[model samples]
Target chain A: MGRLTLPDADVIPFGSPGDPDRPGRGLGPSKAARLVGNTGPQPTSPPAAAAPTSRSATDADRPEHSTSHDVITDAEIPFDGESWLEFARRRLMGDYSVDDFGFDPELTDRVLLTLVRPLYRSWFRVETTGLENVPADSGALVVANHSGVIAMDSVMAQVALHDEHPAHRHLRMLGANLVFQTPFMGEVARKAGHTLACHPDAERLLAAGEIVGVWPEGFKGVGKPFGQRYKLQRFGRGGFVSAALRTGAPIIPTAIVGAEEIYPMIGNAKTVARILGLPYFPITPTFPWFGPLGMIPLPSKWLIHFGEPIRTDHFPEGAADDPMVVFNLTDQVREQIQQSLYRLLVKRPSAFG
Target chain B: MGRTVLVTGVSRYLGGRMAALLAADPQISTVIGVDVVAPDSPIAGTDFVRADIRNPVIAKVMGEASVDTVVHMGVIATPKQAGGRSTMKEINVIGTMQLLAACQRTPSVRSLVVKSTAAVYGSGPKDPAKFTEDMEPRHSPSSGWPKDSVEVETYVRGFARRRPDVSVTTLRFANFIGPRVETALTAYFSLPIVPTVLGFDPRLQFIHEDDGLEAIRTAVLSPRQGTFNVAGDGVLLLSQAIRRARRQTIAIPSLIFGTVGRTLSPTGLADFSSEAVRYLTYGRALDTRAMHRTLGFDPMWSTDEAFMSFVRRDSADGEVDVA
Candidate 1:
């Protein structure tokens, strides 16, 4: 299925790739122009030529290079002189601070996010909508439909919020136990500000005024057959709803489309899954047949839409404990995400386009 | 009208310093230091009583001294220090049982402060970011100091219930790190090249030696009822701490980290049990809000400040900062 219809602002704000600094500026052309003039080349790095010594060569060249770029960088790069060296020194000296969640703001903001930018921008071509629904400040639980065998959709959504939004807030993701059980990836996940998808961690992060993201669909949505692509799997016991209700954080149902096309899970090897202690052993179109090359997700055009927030604060004190209230809210969030998915699917031209 | 105090495990670092500090305090009338062996260095202004807490004689010591405050700091962290795992268990579990029994009998002992560990929370992938006072381990620990701490807490709770009038303060402290105290954590950091579990950067919290002692002193002077998590203001990622200490790390696999740590650091300064290995992988943090509010005790140094002080001073020399 494909669309020949013209792009609309109601579906998505703007073409994210067009604006380098501010990704989504379809709100207004005049406002975008005013912002570009005010912000300048600070948050993101300028073109290679504008700053001659933009790339760091070695520890020896750092001292001279740092002084030259001190004015341009001190605000964002944040160290007084020789930012790379100073950052390294500060890191080595253990001068840096991490939150109780082991979230390294410096590492996540500069390094981890930078690593994911290319995937979010060039590869996925992720375009987001209804960012205004996400509170600029304060806590909000982002309930999103999980898909894409590899789960690149979650990362893209995180990047979309951080890059596209006016406030540029980070989404503290609640991840599965597998993400944390695996080697190397676990540490990266924590440093990137992710924790185990547990009740306590979710409530704690929310109470601390963090934008918490949870994919209740989990592995069921991720490793499902390609035929059942857009169809949402069972949301986990509605734990996300309880966490939101407890913290009184409004639930923002986020819909991420085009991720299901990536990897295209044709079948699942149940025996292999059982042996390996994984949720499912995904047999994608390119995977196993193409070997390691198959791991590269299909360049599917991504569309993320944030729905209107469902207020949990209005509910009664013992609402979190009430199965009826939780079930109702969970269904509401699921329906909203499903509705947005259909809307986004209609707007996008094609999977690759 | 100063309170008479009885301190256990005065032979070790934390207990000896605690006894010395309690003896110096104007609020304490007499410091009766009880230990199986003599302290490594004599604790001034303390009446040293050669008493094994495992024996029933501790009750006699408590009765004779007319001790108003009982501070149990003898819970050993590492098995190597206590000769074996069984001995460590006996000292930690049975020793606490005997000590509590003695306190229960000695009517004069109105206040009890048991120094517990956050290890009772038990580190795992399933653990919460910060453990509150009431939270239990995700997996009930079956072995090591974590298990011992859990058992010790259970008995302390039982003691509180039995003796309704006695004000029992359970301070669940995070990892101890400072210039003077020599713990498994301190020894692990002091290594020429520390070995860490690969692919895991655990979140660790620390309470400086001075702050820990001060908290104990406060408990002794003005007793508080109920449990409290005693940690400094913040937490530290293990990797950052290693780097800050300027120690090279050889990361071993999670499975074999215990083995590598044992073989590499033959000095037995650090524990390499399954519980400790899990801790190395997923470190634990405590909610010390109750310590600040209920106990009215404020730590002078934060976790970061406390760790940095230890790294700065300890790495300079293997010797203790305080004489």
Candidate 2:
């Protein structure tokens, strides 16, 4: 596959290029023409000539094929913010309402929210100490440390948020490419509102003012070896901070206790993994080799805490560019979430204890 | 010179045949036949003893007979008759162990010959190749059939290891056909509306009753003490066998019969249905060259000859055969 590159110019032009004041106006025809000229138009002809027929041989019979260079790249595809919003609306028509996007407009979302309450009660054992901390209606990035080898904890967090909050927002999760490649699992993930965790995807969701969730540690956090349980894995040089900085969304540092014990990875068979085309052959107490009997996770009573939101509006523009500042800020946020989880772990007894 | 021999399960067809053959031999003075119930008419000059080998009385009986060799064939041959592993363990494993222990106690008993099954190999390539005594048993849980065979083999090996004085020989007998063959193969072929292959073939091996008895007689008489696979002189597919029998054989996918048999019959996972599927679909040909080389004996009848003899006998008996 070819490498994915960022667009030369931003797809959604929020304000005038090199200007701050002019916002919400669409890029004019001159800009559109320039963009088209730079990248060329989509191919309008087939690659092969049509077979000759006895019925008619007209001027259109000439072998016409567009060159590969004529096709526009993703970078040059013009994005109208209103058009995208309308597209998303149309795609979700009838099945979903505006209230479904975490608004208590007609109390329909409240009923749907009620439907998943039992699952929340059984799964997460969700206890909200600071219900006041969560804004009644705002796009907040709930940053939680991912546990469980396959981001099952992240799913439970989504389930918990949708169940507890009256608005019932379905948190859009940013997942890795591997998650989307698995057979039956990929479809289930898309239905659960999880998209590939790329800069463009994250930025687009954030720009749309949707509640986005991310695990900075990625697979490293989930697939921590048997020796390191509950200990956080390394979070790569702060891409999450940059996304938050660009969108000015509050980062709600969340801590989820008890997801670590669900499936304890006792051992791993590297040879089996290479043969099966899996990243790791986890020898958990139960798994892929066995049936439903293996799928059952050890019942660990869950406790999810939504910490006070850390506002990003105060930071000056381009604060993400300062390496030292970004590093220090990312470290501080990581330490805060880590310490909170450690404290929670100590406060509660074992899942069964 | 006369020798004394103890044969367990003498009431059964193969055991009875072995007992009668040994009794007829002038070298054998006395033959002790052990069973739960004594045979109505014992083999000529053979002593009938009522004793379950699973019980401790087996050692006492062997002690009284002072037999020179013990041929153990006292096992529930079919899984349905055996019930489950526990029941099979009581009869096959524990019973074999008890008989082995009895042989160990009797000072005169120098050899112990046990009847094992070729099904111990489970399902594999039917490449007409020989499987030596050392080939590991394929223990599969798809059905309890393979497990039962493996367990029996394991118990025998353990017993052999524990008793160094006794020379143990296990014979893995092939599918046998004779006058009284009542297995699924006989039942399937004897049916009025015989199900034959549409076009596909099946490789089968059958030992005649007399030849099977000769194999046991030779094993008991000879002082050799290793395992050997015993089968008929040659191999033939079911279609070929039916054709040789001069009977009309239809051709059909073996799976259809298996599905129908499983659905219609009460013996869903019995050895009969499983063996039928195994033979008709995935037939295996065993190499019995070692039996000829070591025992200096060859099966007198081929599968076709034995099966034809069976068909002739059935016809003469005027039995109503239904498929």
Candidate 3:
């Protein structure tokens, strides 16, 4: 059977040569066209005259053609971001439980977590205090200050918990809905043990005797301008406290410092964010100016401090339903995190030291 | 008390097997198998009737036979079996509408079991890991068998509303794979070389043909209210499933996966439709807790066991008559 050829250059232009924004780099049209011509369709492309009708005719003629175990010469397609070995490793570690949340422990530990370990340990030089405050084996809601243009602190905190804590517990983080809606990001987040930051999901994870993490500051803390960098934003609605109250899981107010300096959000592209259906399109000093290179996060000296765990077991039977209790508890946790962040910042010698 | 049961699409393997199985039951006095064409092998203790379910005459047939229960197994899974896309759609959607209309008119029909598919809960990126019976499809299928299944189910719901007394059960079976079953999934897996969407390994679930038949038998014998998700326990990733099938895989980018799939779809190696590729991109699974707790039935085979069984059967024959 003859091989099917890719459409001609005229028909499918992936990236225009003249598009300045695209920079004609990173697996652009030229590479795609070359890959298609050189590496695609191993059996040899059908003759130009036979191109259109070739597929159907070939199909009709040889119905049970056994190409099983044949070497697929067409490997170098677009999205050539990961090496073959890396890709294979990811595949091997992709198994997960039958839960509806789609959390894959193998993928998270071997791929996603490992992918960021270097950044957390060496690049950020992260130091953690009061690690003993985190419960050894049971469910607890770790409430932390959310910062950085991107929420890398949450991931670093996850790494800290997984690597440092004696019990090596996993933190099932509650994330924004936007992350789950996006294509690749959504899948990656789920595999890394993050679920929708709604009450039901949070309560389920907590009740299951798993460590749960929440950054109630959300987009406000992450997308704040550089001038308001270390200042803690108002924690939203006290939903995390309600979840803690309902599950009777202790709330550990965790604080992270030095994250606000990484990719400092100097300006906001509100229009672009709206178009993309994102919370905020942040513009740092290096971004757009340096293109893809701007995405490289600055190596900041990090410090994460865990405060005393607040006992929710003492709350009355239906304290979760009480607005005043939820509100007061939310303020208490927020205040602890805010105070801890200030203390950690004062102790640090320099941002990148 | 004996039942007069009418089963549709008797020409198909599962339909014929189910009809024959039901005839053996002491509770069923008579079983009538109706199809557009005759079955190759005559099923014992059953009467075969040649009739187009799409025709209004189906209502008369249901009335004349005094069928107390109706088993609608007429839904087509693949385009090739039904002659083409348009024909499959007509037989699946229009035929179902006509059959349900017939069931609505027949007051003697106390129970209805509609064979449905898990494809209605499409495999989208944003879909919950496992689909429960209650959740709607993340994205409604645009065309082909999945679309038809959605329509068929909608018609069944409408029929239920009209006949409130009748016990309606919709068993949304996961992709069926076994020695005797012929489906799009089986055809795709039987391919010598399978091409998959690059960088995506979706979880897959399957129910053995034996389990599938037994579920139908259970539904027919002990009719239940509400929908149930019918799949074996556990799931297999697409890559792992291919490895088990002992087939070579070519991973193409999503950009060219469609073009490559379009080229391969007609080749008869795989049923590589746009919908099929979407399944590959985001593999689908169903939560069968309802199938156990609500429907009160457990599949004999797990997802892995079912696929392995199919692989063993295919290897023994080495050639499948895809119809």
Candidate 4:
């Protein structure tokens, strides 16, 4: 080997200074050999070591490649796709776990419970009753009245379960598509362990022995006029009952009061809403025309009451499919929840009562 | 024969109540409540018309109703919602122009009572003496653009000048409080905790909502002309007002407090964006002698009385922890 002497600062190690013809050095021998042919005795120079004080003139001139900056190596691939348990453990210092659907365990519950606590406190003030009726361990399907144009009541219900319940069981919510469409909101929903309330999602969560919540009234229920605040909207085809029957989960009818007063929909801007591609522009004391600043809900006191769970264990497997059975079951649940809310309202003196 | 009066912005907190009060009076035969959003139900015997007063269509409607007086209260009261002086000019200035034009075309229209604000003063001197109707608006060119109050006042004055026969009375109202209040300042001061200065006291003034309604009623019934300062007895310091709020006081530097408040509160900073900040910081004791003398009106509640009433009502309702 010939001695290649250079200045102290200019010294380069062999195979370090990439050959003009060969760019990817030390990536692997095969990649290096492919770049620079193995046929000749290429002069072995010291690695291209630049002085610490010197700026590399060619730093900005690097060639562009097809691969992304965040590409993972083949070795990084786990046996069965990335497990949320492992990812959360490594990323979140094992402080988090994965829910049934691979959501951040600790964060999912934390966000859900935190959002629900204030709502639960508010709910207690308005119409809360039958806290003792909630079973300690069994999976239950909580069907509640939904009102408040934005479905803020659903969030209130989820919060009620997490904060008021002794066991602190995480209630998986079925959110609407509009919620997921809003920016910064969609990610929060998913991480908080809410999924679409479609049959598959309901079945999956219920089958895993997890408490599932469904608002049968959906948009129609929550978006009712201020005049019809406490009135429950029409429940759609008994899909909740079918989900309960399929998973053998008990149906727990729930009612929420005071969510209606938060943002009273005094009027609607139908023309503006249609033009802007929105459901309906609510002319509350604040909203859309007022911007996001308007969305700050009035701190109205709330009340939530959970009724005794109707056991479906004794019913036949396909009992939900029977029209008469579904209709009767749905009516019974709705009437019970409605009556409880009215009684609670009567007992309470005012709107914030 | 009973007279017909047209009131716009009747759906607003102040305007709506004013309409209700006017409609209840037996002297007013027909009260036409005009607004973009009509009330769910008509105000007793009053006729309700869901029409944007800014629109030309209002002239046809008002003419048909045989409106003898036009009480122009349909204004974007909040500076935050008004956008800029141009916006204020558009709705307050031009809206008045259109309504005035409608009134002129309607032969029965003889009077115009405008609900202007003491804001026209734009942070006047804190002297105990009251301002007269002839007193030149204390607004300065250096104080930035005119707010809705000033613009609306100027527009009404110009309209009065052109149409001499049409008796125009501009009521420069001070801070008024009563039931169904929606002002940011009122809500802020009524909160469980009010952010205020320990030593510095800015003068505060208010008229009861009933008093304000009474003033409007007086303006409508009487043959009064020109401008009048519709205010209570005197001014109360910011400290006194905050204390009256009954909420715990968080003493913070005005500048720092305002910065944090503007960030956290929706109405806080945005409300002050207009020259209204000048009035908020500096003391302005408005003179209400003209309102009392001209309209033969006396406010039932003073600043202290109004504040205590608000605190009592709010506390009793448990809407807020006044203590």
Positional deviation of B88 in candidate 2, in angstroms? 5.1
TM-score-wise, the better of 1 and 2 is 1
- Please give the RMSD to the true structure for each candidate, in Å: 7.8, 24.8, 18.1, 29.7
Give candidate 1's whole-model lDDT. 0.80
**Cα misplacement distance, residue B294 of candidate 3 (Å):** 2.1
Best by lDDT: 1
DockQ score, prediction 1: 0.66
| Candidate 3 residue-wise lDDT, A162-202, digit = tens | 65443446788988767765557765777677777877678
Question: Can you list the residue pairs that collide in candidate 1?
Answer: none
User: Model 1 fnat?
Assistant: 0.80
Q: Can you write out model 3's per-residue Cα lDDT over B1-323, one digit (the tens) per residue? A: 69999999999999999999999999999999999889999998899989999899899989998899999999987777888888888899889999998998888999999999999988675565567788878767887788899999999999899999999999999988987788877877766667887766667889999999999999998999989989988888777777767676788887788778657656553666778778888777787888999899999999888988998888789653321
lDDT of 1 by residue, A241-319 (tens): 9999999888888889889888888888989999999989999878888999999888888878876678888798999
Q: Give the TM-score of candidate 2.
A: 0.45
Report lDDT (CA) for all predictions.
0.80, 0.60, 0.76, 0.63
Candidate 1 vs. true structure, TM-score:
0.88
User: In candidate 2 chain A, where is summed lDDT lowest over 10 consecutive residues?
Assistant: A46-55
Question: Could you tell me every candidate's TM-score relative to the true structure?
Answer: 0.88, 0.45, 0.77, 0.45
TM-score ranking, best first: 1, 3, 4, 2
lDDT of 4 by residue, A26-136 (tens): 222232222222111112321132111122233212221111113222123342354556744444322223332324445544334544554445443333344334444
